[model samples]
Target: MVATVNEFDQTATNPGQRGPAEHQRREQILRAAGEHFRHYGYRKTTVADLAKAIGLSPAYIYKFFVSKQAIGEAVCALCLGERTGALRKIVEETASPVESIRKIYKSLALSGARLFFEDRKMHDIVTASFEERWGNLEAYNHDLIGIIRRVLIRGRELGEFERKTSLEEACRAIQHTMQSFFHPILLEQNLDHLEEDATAVANLVLRSLAP
Candidate 1:
C-alpha cells in the first residue's frame, strides 16, 4: 500500500487529548529514533538506547513505538517514501519511457553507491530489514513493475516499442534487472564506478525492449 503524505503528517500528530507540545515531542522522538536506528542495527539497538539518545525515559519510547521492530519498520517506511518519491518524479518528468527507466536505475545506483561507501552500517541495516520483511519488499517490487508496465503499455500504444512484446514480460524483465543491479553486494563490489555499470545495464534493457 502506498503511504500517503497525509498519513505521515497524521502519524506526527498526537491521537489523544494532548496539544501541539505533545505532537512536537512525538516528532522529535521519532526523528531521534531514526538517527539511532541508522547508526545501530535494528537487532542491536534497544529502546533504552533510543530513549537515552533523545533524553527520554524508556517507558516514553514504548509509548511512541511499541517495540524496536516497530520503530525499525517506521524508519524503513520513511526511507522508502523518500526513495520512491524521487524515482516517481524522475519517471513522471522524463519524456521517453526508456529514458525514464535509465534515470531510475542511475538514481538508485548513485544512491546505493553513496550508502555503500559513506554509510555501510546503514546499508547493512536496510538490506537486513528488507530481507527480513520480504512481504513489504515483494510489494515494493510489484509496485515498481506496475510503473514500468504502465510506461511500456503507453510506449506500445504510441508505437515507440514493438507491439509484439508483452508489457507484463517487459515489466518483469526490467524489474529483475533493476533488482540485480541494485543489490547491495553488487553495489559494494562495483563502488568505484557504479554509475557506469548501471548505465550499461540500462542500455541493455532498453535495447531489448526497444522496437
Candidate 2:
C-alpha cells in the first residue's frame, strides 16, 4: 500500500519508506484522531474517541502507535508532509524560475498560518512533536531546502538569475532571510497581512538575484 497522506500513526521511520499496510492502517487512525483532536483539543480527545471514530478498539490503535503522543506527532508529520509535497512539485515542474520561486517563498512563510493558526489543533500536534523530536519538521526542512536549491540552480542555468553566490550560499541565504516570514512564532505574532508580507520578502530576495 502506498503511503497515503492519511498516515496518522508511525514509528518515526522515513515516511516515504513505510510499509503499505502500515500506511493504510495508520492513516485510518490519523484521520479519525486528527478530527477528534481538532474538535475536542488534544487532552480531551481520548484513544477511545479516536478508535470509535474509526470503528476500532483502543487496543488496536496501540498496535500501530505507542501512545496518544505518537499519534499527535504523526498528525503533525502528515500536515508538514503535504507542504513538502507541494514545494517538491513546484521545484520539479515550474518553468518560470522567478514566478515559481516567489510563490514557494511566499508559501513557506504563510505555511504556519495556513497549517497551524487557522486550525490550532495542528499547532497542538506540533508542540507535542517538538517535545520528543522534530518529527517530520527536520525531514521537511531538509527536503524543502534541497528543492529550493534545485530551483535556484535551474534559474542560473536558464539565465533568469545571476550567479552572485554559490548555490549553497544562495539557498541558505534565501532561507535565512525569509525566517521572519516563515518561522512559526514570528509569523503567528504578525498574522494579518502575512501573505503580503511574505510576498514582499520573496520579491525582494528574487530582485537581489536578478541578472
Candidate 3:
C-alpha cells in the first residue's frame, strides 16, 4: 500500500514511541535543516552548520538525520509532492487531453519555475540532490511518464489525438523534450521569454499529436 503524507508525518512524529518533546525537537531540526539547505547549497551546508542554526549540538542533529543527504531527500520529497499534485489535478480535471498537456507544461514552466528559481541556492541543492539520488529521480520520472501516457492513450480512444504514434514513444518524447525547462539551462538564458518558450514547446508537442 502507498503511504499517505499523514502516515509519514505520524511516523516522523512518533518514531519508536518517542515523547512529544522529542517529536517537536525532531520537527524543529528538520525545519532548520530545510532552511539551511535552501539558503546554502547542499555542498556548503553541513550538519554542524544546521546544529548551530537550530541551537543543537552536532551529535544531537545526527540523532535525527544520519547525513546531510538524508535531510536533502526529505526536502525533495516534500517539494516534489507540490509539483506532482498540481500536475495530477490539472490532468484529472481537464476534458481535453491536449489542453491537459498544455496546462501541465505551463504550470511546470511558470509556477514550478518560480518556486524553483526564486532561490538560487535551493535550485542548486535540488539539482545536485536529484542527480545524486538517481533511483528516486527515475521513479519520479517513470510515474510522470505513466500519467502522460495514460492521457495520450485515452485521447486516442476518444479520437482527440492521432492514433499513429505509440503511447510509450509519445510520452517519452514529451518527457525528454520537457527536461530542459527543469534543469540549469533556464538560468543561463533570459527568463523574460519563459511564457513564450513554454507555450511554443507545449504547442509543438500538442500539434504533433493532433487528430
Candidate 4:
C-alpha cells in the first residue's frame, strides 16, 4: 500500500512554527542520524545510539523524535527531498521537453547506480524504505510523476509529442517503463551497461511520443 507524506512529516514540528533552538536541534539530530544511518546502517542504529553520537541522552532525543522509526522516516524524507529538488532543477533548466525527458532518464539511472555502487551502505536506508512501503517513497514518486506530466503537457502543446493519449496515461506509462532505471531495488540488478540501456529506454519512450 502507498504511504502518505504525513507518515514522515508527523515526526517533526512544522518548520514555520519551529523556534530557532528547536530547528537547530532537529537539524543536529538529522545530520547525526544521517551519518550513523549511512555508516552503521539504519537497522543496527538505535535511538540511544543516535543520542550518544550527538552527546544527548536518549530521553532528550525522544523529545524531538518519538521513536527510531520516526527518525528513519525523517531521514528518508530528507534524502528523497534532495533528489526531487535536483530533478526539478533539471526540468526547469532544460528548454526542450524531448531533451528534458532524456536528461531525466539519464539522471535517474546515473544517480541510482551511484547509490548502488559507491554508496551501497547509505543505500540500505533507501532499500528499507522501499521494502517497508514507507510514505516518503510514494511522496517522492508523486512529485516525480507530476514533473513528467508537466513535461508531457508542454511537449503536446509544442506539437512535439502525440496528444492522442491523455497526459495522465502518458506520464504513468512513462514512469512504469522507466522504473528499472530509477527505482533503487530494481536498478541494482541492471548496473551493467546501465547508460546504454537507459538511453535506449528513453529513446523508445521518446519515439512513442512523436507526433
Q: By descending TM-score, how would the candidates be arranged?
A: 4, 2, 1, 3
Best by lDDT: 4
Off by over 4 Å in 4: 1-22
Per-residue lDDT of model 2, residues 116-193, tens digit only: 658887766665555546546677668768877888888899999998788888888887776666556666676887
RMSD of each: 6.3, 5.6, 6.5, 4.8
Q: In candidate 4, what are the lDDT values of residues 65-184, reduced to their tens digit?
A: 656766777788787777777778888999899999999889888887887788776678888888897756767889889989888988999999999997888889999988898677
Model 4 clash number: 0
Q: Stretches of candidate 1 above 4 Å error?
A: 1-26, 40-43, 55-60, 134-136
User: Which of the numbered candidates is closest to the native, going by highest TM-score?
Assistant: 4
Per-residue CA lDDT of candidate 3, range 92-167, in tens?
8999888888887787777656765686666666677565662335546766787788789878988989988777
Q: Quote the positional error of residue 12 for candidate 3 in Å.
A: 16
Looking at candidate 1, the ten consecutive residues that score lowest on lDDT are: 1-10
Number of backbone collisions per candidate: 0, 0, 0, 0
TM-score of 4: 0.87
Candidate 2: where is the Cα deviation over 4 Å?
1-12, 15-23, 109-111, 127-133
Q: For each candidate, what is the lDDT?
A: 0.68, 0.73, 0.69, 0.80
- CA RMSD (A), model 2: 5.6
Clashing pairs in 4: none
